[model samples]
Target: MNLTVVGLGLIGGSLAKDLRSKGIAKHIIGVDKNPDHCNKAKELGIIDEFQPLDKAVANADLVIVSVPVNATLKVLTMVLDLIDDKTVVMDVGSTKSEICKVVENHPRRKNYVANHPIAGTEYSGPVAAIEGLYDKKTTIICDQDKSDPKAVLLIKVLHEAIGMHVIHMEAEEHDRHIAYVSHLSHVISYVLGKTVLEIEKDETNIFELAGSGFASTARLAKSNPDMWTPIFMQNKKSLLKAVDEYQKNLQEFRDLIAGDDEKALYNEIGRINDIRRVLEGLALKRAQGN
Candidate 1:
């Protein structure tokens, strides 16, 4: 396969490395606005070479877009514009509803596949990318019916080739569900980190007393804002609703504590413990996947 990856950051760089390692792509080309990133990608041997966006995608068999969600809207259109009819395109953007809508009426709409690889770390850039990032990770294919069957199958095969579990869902539904699980968790981590940092400015003992639980929960705060800000903005409609729901739950817990309602708090906490079962199920799946 001749593949072109548009953004040479963690996701794009990782994909390039993995495809090459897996022998899925015979020649891999990269495109990025950052020459430094391109240079780093070459130094790391993540991509064969870097080319201009138009030239890189011109004769490729497939183009994998891994830019930020906001940039994805424009980049995807631009990629579709450059590719020939046989080329298949996929974007690994976080949000999908708006992205799917942007090219809904394009002549090459059927050539594009809307996908989100549910994987990453609180890091960015080519230097942070690693092979096997997608191993056992879940990748969602949204609006599968809209894409050409061949394109959809090709994307599915590619994901499977890279050791990803595939799922299909409507783009809007994918956005709504992801807002609660992925976006809301990032917001919580960012806020939790912010809250502690604000307090730490006055009381430096905060980190000294912090434990692993805090570290784990706040880890996503270290994620690149350039990538996440666009995600939060593009998915604002669904994210806002998720935030409101989270706030309601937070207020309930606060009220319970303030009211000295120990019994109610105990019951509420116990009820929420059911999430442990769900988590355990995910753990079992991960173990089995390995």
Candidate 2:
């Protein structure tokens, strides 16, 4: 397939690399607002060449818009308008409901598919593109019934080629679930990093006090704000609810600690530890390339 990737950052560049390696993408044309990223992607062999959006979409069999959530809706609409009847367009934005709602009545709506690939590192740019980044990951295709069947099948084939499992659900449900599973984690990480930074005036002593646990928890805080800020805005309602629930749980823990309810605190910690089994299963699946 002749693929055109709209953003040559981590997600787009990574997809370009895997798709080419898997022989799913015959040639990739990159389109990025950043010329540096486009040049970097080409230098790294992530994309074959760089082209203007209009020209790229004109000849592409598939167009993947991997830009930020705020930019995705506008770019997707433009790409859909430019695409021919046979061409398929997909976006890998974090939020889905807003994008879906905006394009619900578009003339070429059927050509577009709303997708969220549950994969990434706490890194951005073409240099951070890993070869097997999407391996054994779950890609959610929201409102699949609204897209053309052939386009949906092509998207499924593309994700499967990179070792991802494809599932379908409503766009609203996808937004809600991801607000808790993905967005909430990032929020916690950002807040945790801010809290630590506020306390650690002596940066030199931070590393001495920190360990793997702190590093792991704060890793997502290093993610690009340009990307995350838009995601938080797009899914504001769901994200607020997630934040509210998280605050309630945090208060519960605070109350337990303040009231000297040692047994309650211990039991709560033990209960949360049950997530270990689920995480282990996920790790096993990824390791086995399921």
Candidate 3:
């Protein structure tokens, strides 16, 4: 298959590199509005060549759109007119409902498979691409029933070949779950970073004191704002709900600390400990390929 990867950022560049490394595509072409990304993707051998969007989609058997959530609709709109019946188009945007809705009535809707791969690091751009990033990750396919069987199967096969576990869900359900698990975490991390930076204004070496727990919790703060801002905006309702719940939890903790309520603090800490145990189990299950 000849694959064309749009955007050529962390996800797109990584996908292109993996496809070539695994011999999954006969030729891989990349498209990016950023000339620097185009040059870097080629220099790093992430793509066989870089071409204009029209030419790349014209020749590709598969097209992967891995741009920002806001930019996805515009890019898809531009390419929907050019995709052939045999070409399978898939996007890896963070939010799905809006993008799915935009392309729902298109004649080529059947050729487009909407997917969200549940894996990434707090990095961006072609330079951040890494191998094995998608291995053992859960890939959520929304509204699979609405997509053409052939296109769906092709995408399922492609993700599975790269060691991803495929699961299907409604777009609304995917958005809700991700708002809590993914989007909320990023928000917390960003706020935590801001909070710490505020206190560290005079303590230049405070970051040096940060250990594993702080590092783990604040890791998402390094994510690209350009990419994430649109996602937070697109999924505003769900994300706002998550943020409200998070604020309530934080307020409860603050009250416990303020009142020096030992029992309440202990109980709250125990509840969070249970969450740690659940995450540990998930990590183990993923490791064992359960």
User: Which one wins on TM-score?
Assistant: 1
Candidate 1, which segments miss by more than 4 Å at Cα? Answer: none
Task: Point out where model 2 deviates above 4 Å.
Answer: 202-204
Considering summed lDDT, which 10 consecutive residues are worst modelled in model 3? Answer: 13-22
Which of the predicted structures, 1 or 3, would earn the higher TM-score when compared with the native?
Answer: 1
Candidate 1 lDDT, 1-290, residue by residue in tens: 99999999999888888889899998989899999998999899988899999999987999999999989999999988887799999999999999999999989999999999999999999999999999988999999999999999999999889998999999999999999999999999999999999999999777889899999999999998999999999899999999999999999999999999999999999999999999998888876774
**Each candidate: RMSD:** 1.0, 1.2, 1.1
Per-residue C-alpha lDDT of model 3 across residues 101-199, encoded as one tens digit per residue: 999899999999999988888999999999889888889899998899989999999988888899999999999989999999999999999999999
lDDT of 2 by residue, 163-229 (tens): 9999999999999999999999999999998999988885657768799999999999999998999
**Alpha carbon lDDT at 108, candidate 1:** 96
Rank order (by lDDT, best first): 1, 2, 3
Evaluate candidate 2 by giving its C-alpha RMSD to the native, one decimal: 1.2
